[model samples]
Target: MSFASDNQSGASPAVLNALMQEFSRNGTSYGTDEATKRAEDKLRDVFDCDLVAYFVTSGTAANCLALSALGDPWGAVLCHHQAHLLRDESTAPEFLTNGMRLVPVAPFAARLDADAVAAQIAAMPDDRPHNIRPQVLSLAQSSENGQVYTPVEVRALCRVAHDAGLRVHMDGARFANAVAHLGCHPADISVRAGVDVLCLGATKNGAVAAEAVIFFDRTLAREFPERMKRSGHLLSKGRFLGTQFSAWLHDDHWLDLARHANEKAQALATALTSINGVRIAMPPEANEVFAVLPRQVCAQLGAAGIGFAEWYGDAILPDKIELEREILVRFVTSFASNETGVAAVTLAGGVLSR
Candidate 1:
């Protein structure tokens, strides 16, 4: 059983089949192919709006391109301190934005707190280039901690960001899972919630590796195609990227995959709560469950060939968990997670059986 990451899973059967079908069809290159067109149409249908979208192979490229499209080089992108764009992307956002600063703001309830963001935006010294004006406000759906943001929460942050002349960007790395959990239309928390651009991810849900940089405010995408081409994200035979999304989104297969993962995570969280030495840290709003596991249980799970991500830091973790003897672990369930796997891990712990 592996909970290392959602990326550990293989592509969904539908996505694989779509790719196989595309193998025989000869199409134009660089997102001009039939598969590419099909994927774009699927997104428009999913979000229920006309928009511009570009397919890429990684979320990094999607975020970088989408953010760069909204801000100038001297501007700043405000995002949660623990956001993937801030901590995990390894300067890609900076390099692509040409040194556009990713200013970290405190996140409350697993999202960019509207008050904190507004205060930061106002606190900036905007006296004629003395300091960079914050131009973008970025928040992650199914946040890094695996908590989902509600539509009302999204609307508040968006309103605050927009009032201060800031464009909103959502790092939807687990977009499908968030929507599946919220039981809301994709547009309800995104475009309709005032997000200017979205880095919609499919790879972590069920695709092999495909992401979309979607501009709900189509005007922000004016120079994005040229930027994407220069950044090497514009795949030559882009049909491969397109085929993944085309099949993953068809018939709402993406939501189906996400629901399975979220169910497994919720079940695991419930089981872990009964264990003697485990404490549900973040209480999982999506497919990721963060819990404090006793050091002995950690060893037991590892010995049984079960793997997990040992998350560091006590930023959001409470004082109830003893950091000295317990480790903060992230248990991530994906489309591939099954009941058998969850049982083996939850029951395998010697510490739990006590």
Candidate 2:
């Protein structure tokens, strides 16, 4: 009955089964096992390119370590103000980069365009010795506001960043959802779009905890192993992380799970908007639905044990929408989400509205 977050959901059956199978076996440690190799190979096959893929236990570790490699100590990484790296990661990027600054760029709907990035870079002081030089542009696929960046948009942003001598990194914690929403291949929106590195996340999708830091430009990944070790992110039982991803990617299981979650979110958004005094704050682009409901209705939903969260960020609200007595809420669906839970929430809202 919880719509609070995909993170609250349990691992998918496929992922759990893989973990169980791997737990019974003895394998080499520290990413030297066959399972770890298979997982990296799976990522290469999916991306359709030769890449350096390193597995880690969390999105924060993947992003921080990857950004550490992309940015220098005196450089700046440009990203949307509401990006997870900026708002949620608790300064891990700065700490991992040994004081590389994170420059916030304002972009509508959490999608950063080339112009916005270029302007941010231009605004920095010309005196390189006194001001941090912008060196990386970080984009969030299926952004914090749940808006997916199209391939063309990504390519344009990357071109701008590259022209300004900045590398591009994508925080792809919801990569599967974005690909499912776009109906495009992963490479189309990432590697081919000039993303230098991508933190491919699986924890929110289905795995217990698994994220991959993939470098499209292999040269950028050369130092990642040392970084992982130094940062205490290198797992001794690395096969645990590898097995989950290996199962998640096999037979396109990841996409199927993401599509199911996205469809459920669409259905939930439609139901929410149908209720009087309830309206969507932003488009339901991935597995997240952002809506504004009358305060009384929100209270009713809470009383009925329908779990959701009060959302506060840079979501673009509908014009002329009044929010004096309303609450902006977020509902997240996952591979384990069911129609019963969605229907229950909608039924509660409908009952309360009457």
In the range 17-120, model 1's lDDT, one tens digit per residue, is: 99898888898998888888989999999999999899999999999988888899999999887888988899999999898998988543345678988888
Q: Compared to the true structure, candidate 2 yields what TM-score?
A: 0.97
Each prediction's total of clashing residue pairs, residues at least 3 apart in sequence or on different chains, is 0, 0
Shift of residue 117 alpha carbon in model 1, Å: 1.2
- Which stretches of candidate 1 lie above 4 Å from their native place? 107-110, 318-320
Q: Give the TM-scores of the predictions, in the order they appear.
A: 0.96, 0.97
Global lDDT of model 2: 0.90
List lDDT for all candidates, in order. Answer: 0.88, 0.90
- RMSD values for the candidates in order, in angstroms, are 1.5, 1.3
Local distance difference test, candidate 1: 0.88
lDDT per residue as tens, model 2, 216-268: 99889887888999999999999999999999999999999999999999989
